[model samples]
Target: MSGSGNVHLRQMARQDVAAGMELVQAAGWNQTEADWNRFLDANSEGCFVAEAESTVCGTAATIIYGHQLAWIGMVLVHPDMRGRGIGTRLLRSAVEYLESRGPLVIKLDATPQGRPVYQRLGFEPEYEIERWKLTATPSLHSAPGAIPLDDDKPDIEDVIALDAEAFGASRSALLHSVHRDAPEFTAAISAEGRLLGYTFGRHGLHADHLGPWVAEDQEIARRLLETFLDRSTGRCLIVDCVKAHPFAATLLGSAGFEFSRPLTRMVRRAVQSGRRSGLVCAILGPEFG
Candidate 1:
């Protein structure tokens, strides 16, 4: 356990899921109880919670991708606890934990309010990301070559490989978790029997979130996105898109997706290699990426 003054930090447990959900809901975040569970299930020892006077007041979670990369997310502080140093402490705890594990890179998608705190922790801006939303069904034509991949299908491995190439790290575990939760939202595009792109989605509290959307080019990205949108007709959808990607803005705009907010993709320490930024149209989510 770690603490400063009245604020105490400890490893988040399964029992703390409800408390975590309360913080998420209070922040108007899209995460559900299941999302909280996913973090604990992924890395029980790496997730942390803060307490003040014995009440949980803040939380932070981390997911390490085989020492290549680690993600810090779900950092939250209760409204009443905002002015204290709880958030910083929680972030520090997460960073320290991830650093101990020897990942080459640590990353987080920072809200404007959290950017400065992250900057102070030695995180440098990587790129701008935007959350785009579609409230109504998009008028999308069928993506003829795109095919759906069920969680149990043999093709799922191909999807994982394609994703690893684009994301620069292997996130097969998270991808499997997403597929387990929303298999209907998983799709891929292939040409000449080779995987070109893949996309995954998860059910959010208020919308269907599509992402980690990767492709070889704009046309492939569009096809994957169109497949997702076509399947998610009449439902609210969200995509956290990389601003620098060539196809994101145009595709999202044409599909009637309006920009919601900006998130900065920040990285701690230097990025060595293998990040195919051009291939990644949207990330899984700010919390997961």
Candidate 2:
């Protein structure tokens, strides 16, 4: 356990779910209980919480993908706990735990407030991703060419292969979790019955986030997005788009998704692979990145 003053850090337990959710919600983040479950489900030992006076005050989570890379996110400290060294302790705990597991690279998408802290910890900038939001669903005048993925009988290999090339890591299990949780939003755009592209997302309490969104071209990307938005109508939607891709900017901008904030993808002991901008329009989210 790590602590300073009254705040102390310890391995997060199943009973901490409600308190953990309160920390993230207080930060006005998009994560839900399901998101927290993703981390705990991935590795219960990898998540941590900070507490003071028997109350949770901060949290951090880590998820490793196929022993290749690990991502740290949902790093939060209650407003009352900021500047008390609680965030640092939680972040350090996450890094140390993952380092013990020996992933090639450790990464996280940092907000402006957290970028300097991560840089201080030796995380170098990799790329910029912007959170784009669509207040209202995009108009679906033309029928989408893509079809909803048959959740019961999906071509797992095809979906995994396409995502692996675009995402730079084989997160077949993560994709399976996303699809199983929200299969209605999982879709594919094909031509001549050949897989052109695919997309998957999860519903949050405040909004629905579309991510790990990949495509063969802009048209396929467009169709897949429309299908997701149509199902996600009446709810706030968010997509974290890579700034390097002009097509993503144009497509989202044209669809009325305004830029909200920027997240810098940072890595420690950086790896050369893992960025395929032409095919990857949006990422799975900072937590899963």
Best by lDDT: 1
Across residues 198-220, which tens digit of lDDT does each residue of candidate 2 receive? 88898877889999888888988
**Clashing residue pairs in candidate 1, if any?**
none
Q: What is the lDDT, from 0 to 100, of the residue 9 in candidate 1?
A: 95
Q: Over the full model, what C-alpha lDDT does candidate 1 score relative to the true structure? A: 0.85
Q: How well does candidate 2 match the true structure, expressed as C-alpha RMSD?
A: 2.7
Q: What ranges in model 1 sit over 4 Å off? A: 1-5, 141-154
Cα lDDT listed for each candidate: 0.85, 0.83
**Any residue pairs clashing in model 2, and if so which?**
none
* Candidate 2 segments exceeding 4 Å error: 1-4, 141-154
Model 1, position 254: C-alpha lDDT score: 90
What is candidate 1's TM-score against the reference? 0.92
| TM-score against native, each model | 0.92, 0.92
